[model samples]
Target: MSNRLKTGLILLTIAFLLGCILVQMFTQTLKSEITTLPDGYHNVLIRVPTTFEFCGEQVPLYDEEVKESFDKELYINVFRHSSTSLIIKRSEKFFPIIEQILREEEVPEDMKYIAVIESGLENVRSFAGADGYWQFMEETAKEFDLEISKEVDERFHIEKSTRAACKYLKRSYKKFGNWTLVAASYNRGMGGMNAALRNQNAISYYDVALNNETARYIYRALAFKEIMQHPEKYGFVIPKELRYPPVKYRKIPLDTTINDISALAVKYGMSYKTLKYHNPWLLMNKLTFDKKDLKNKKEYILLVPQNPPMPHSNVLAQESLQMQKMLDSILHEEDTVIDIQDVK
Candidate 1:
């Protein structure tokens, strides 16, 4: 090659390298703050907002360390597309019920997101024996009026579990008066949180030196709230109809002992599996009731689904809606007795 040609090639390569360096520098500068939404839709990157809050409590985003921690959390969730997408979809079905309960109890709407972080809004039993969407243990569940006998475990009951959670949140708020700390207290017990505050000599949750799980708790809840409210911005593109719609069920008043739940299921024109799916609070194969029990508890709410439940689904939810609409017989009247052999 000629010397002149070699020099020209080197100059071109240098220009290209400089351009790449400048681009990388510009992108790094933009990572901390988004002055405007970036162009593009699918597979685009996003940064955490400069200003953030939880239930109206301001995050100290101005501090570099705090901002970086916020950045880490947002990235962890926003990039976890599949799981986060499931959460976005599940929220549509569950949040309506949770929000209504929170509103009725005068709790902040943000508390609904805690359920998302707790069990992904599902009836999950934790390794520690914490069960349901709110993750309450046996004592705690009973302490909050959740019936957890051999026949019933209200921890798996959605509305009842949420009401119990609201009761816990209210008690926490009475002690801390800060919703964020109250959120942290859900993971770090109320006493643990109080001790941390005293030991660290800090008034705010941000100031406390906490264990990894407790420290990450509020941030995870905030991240869930942020992505859920602004799904598109976080690159979650679930359609409105594609999100899981709220479950529908017919409420049956059960006053007598259910000697055999399988028979009870058949009497309702539902499979045994379908019966338990809807009435997760029904803990046993047989529910024994004494006549005396009815004096104080006049009736129990048996949630028999109008159609089978679609847990963690959008397409199945739509299909279930169609099933509910089909012309069908009321296979047995409410008073019909199920055969004992069906139970056997």
Candidate 2:
């Protein structure tokens, strides 16, 4: 055989060998990227029956419009995994207090989910000067009987803000004569919702065309209700033990000025940060004596931590339990429950 022919054949052989090796490497890497699930990883979908009642009007979920809106929220929330998961996690920490307040106020139980959509259950301050889980502006907060001032903004107080929200919802219901409209009015002001109703000549919140946020508001609430009610259907697998536990506290009525909050916290066996964590409404490091209160004689309520849970105690506990279960099930290791002793 000629040397040229021999070289060409050898070169083709080398190229073929290189291509095969590269293909094998790529396949192995892809396989590793797709993590293998252990036995029992797949969970059965749990379906919970849901029916809507708005302003004493029973709305059937099977109705095409209702189903469409419900489906829209369900699909969106299910696919938006991160936000939904966070909402689920936070609900454990905040929902009990919110639910209790809602019950006391005689507000609809479903309305608790409104806070989830409003601030994801965080004490967040909006750029537009709205603050708290319920997102109350200064004037609005004061109008709803929430104290908003330089030293204190009770809008950050979960209980106070929720009560304010209930009042607002009640007022909205009175104006619109519909719970759906009341919910929508939370996004679009009562005046705006009413104006939209008049302009479109539609009485129903579902029928009315609205601005972008208002349009999606009710659907978001419905979606949250569906996903939260049936987490497994939406691919969420949070164990019962993985849910956040409620924090305990005692209320202290303060009639006098606190010169040093740090000292006050230390006196109560807590750090300054801990005091602030529980009482986010306390905006200042030092509490000033209100001269007007002395003449008028009003008392300030301070939430003193009796035995507050450790920071991120609920989240850490949940994550640890989940990881332990996964580790045991996947690795064929013995299931061991780690005792999370209280840190606070």
Candidate 3:
């Protein structure tokens, strides 16, 4: 081969190797950039049944706009896995009680989901200073006969607060003449909703354009209802045991002052913490009652844990007593004596 041709070939080989190295480096840089990019939000598609009735109103879940809104909520809630999971778990403990009250009040059972949207089924204080599972403000709670005080806040009391919510919804329904408006009024006060209705001259909640929070309120409620009703559809598979069970207790009437809750707890064979666990409405270590006043009789209701014999309590108690007697007999036997000091 000619020297010039060999030299050209050698130069070509060097260029090819350099080009290959450059390409490899560029590919890695591109891969890293792709990996580092923030994850894109994926829109989840939820298949809701055609139409669901809430409080005698037909909500078209399958309608295009309704489905889109529902899908948006499903995606948002599903991606917010932690919050949704906790809500689901807490619902197990709270829903039964709320359901019973709603049934008694003749309110729609679906209205129970309203609590989930309001506070995620938690007794949380809002940035606006609203408190409790129902998120009742001081005035509203008082208006509903919920005791809101430093010493006693019944907003934290699930049963009382739920009953208060029922009253509010019923009144809202009477005023608005529709369930959707009633639900929306929960977010925007009855006055606010009425004002909106007058300003917009619209009877329907959907027609009224509202501020951001109030606008999203009804949609969030319906979304919560959708996801919670079929949690499996949202990739939430909580074990039955992971769900909290409703605690059982007997309501004992105690007109007298409870000076020592710890001693009271011990008398019931439970820890003081346990007593408070079941009755969180008890604000202080000691309950004060006006002994002289007749009205004080209704002031106190002590919830004592029903120590109903466990399924195995009888067997275990009997075995423990037998074992104690055997040990006592052995220790107190006069025939059993030992030398004090053998070495001496």
Deviating ranges (above 4 Å) for candidate 1: 1-41, 307-344
TM-score of each: 0.76, 0.75, 0.75
Best by TM-score: 1
Query: Residue 28 lDDT in model 3?
Result: 99
Better of 1 and 2 by TM-score: 1
Using lDDT as the yardstick, the better of models 1 and 2 is 1
Q: Report the Cα RMSD per candidate.
A: 12.4, 13.7, 6.9
Per-model tally of clashing residue pairs: 0, 0, 0
Candidate 2 lDDT at 285 equals: 88
Model 1 agreement with the true structure over 1-344: per-residue lDDT tens digits: 99999999999999999999999999988984555555554664767787888888999987886777777788898888788988888888888999999999989999988898889988999999999999999999999999898778999999999999999999999999999999999999899999999988888999988999988888888888888888888778889899988878789888888789988887777767788977888888888778688777857888887876334344677788777665233434444657789889
Worst 10 residues of 3 by lDDT: 37-46
Distance from true position, residue 133, model 1, in Å?
0.4
For model 3, residues 1-344, the per-residue Cα lDDT tens digits are 99999999999999999999999999999999876745533334566667766667877664587667656776788879889989999988899999999999988888887899888988788998898889999899999999865556888888999999999999988987888889888988899999999999988776788998888777777778878888877777888799876767888776667788878877777777777776777777787666464464556567777863333544788999999999999988877755568435
Candidate 3 similarity to native, TM-score? 0.75
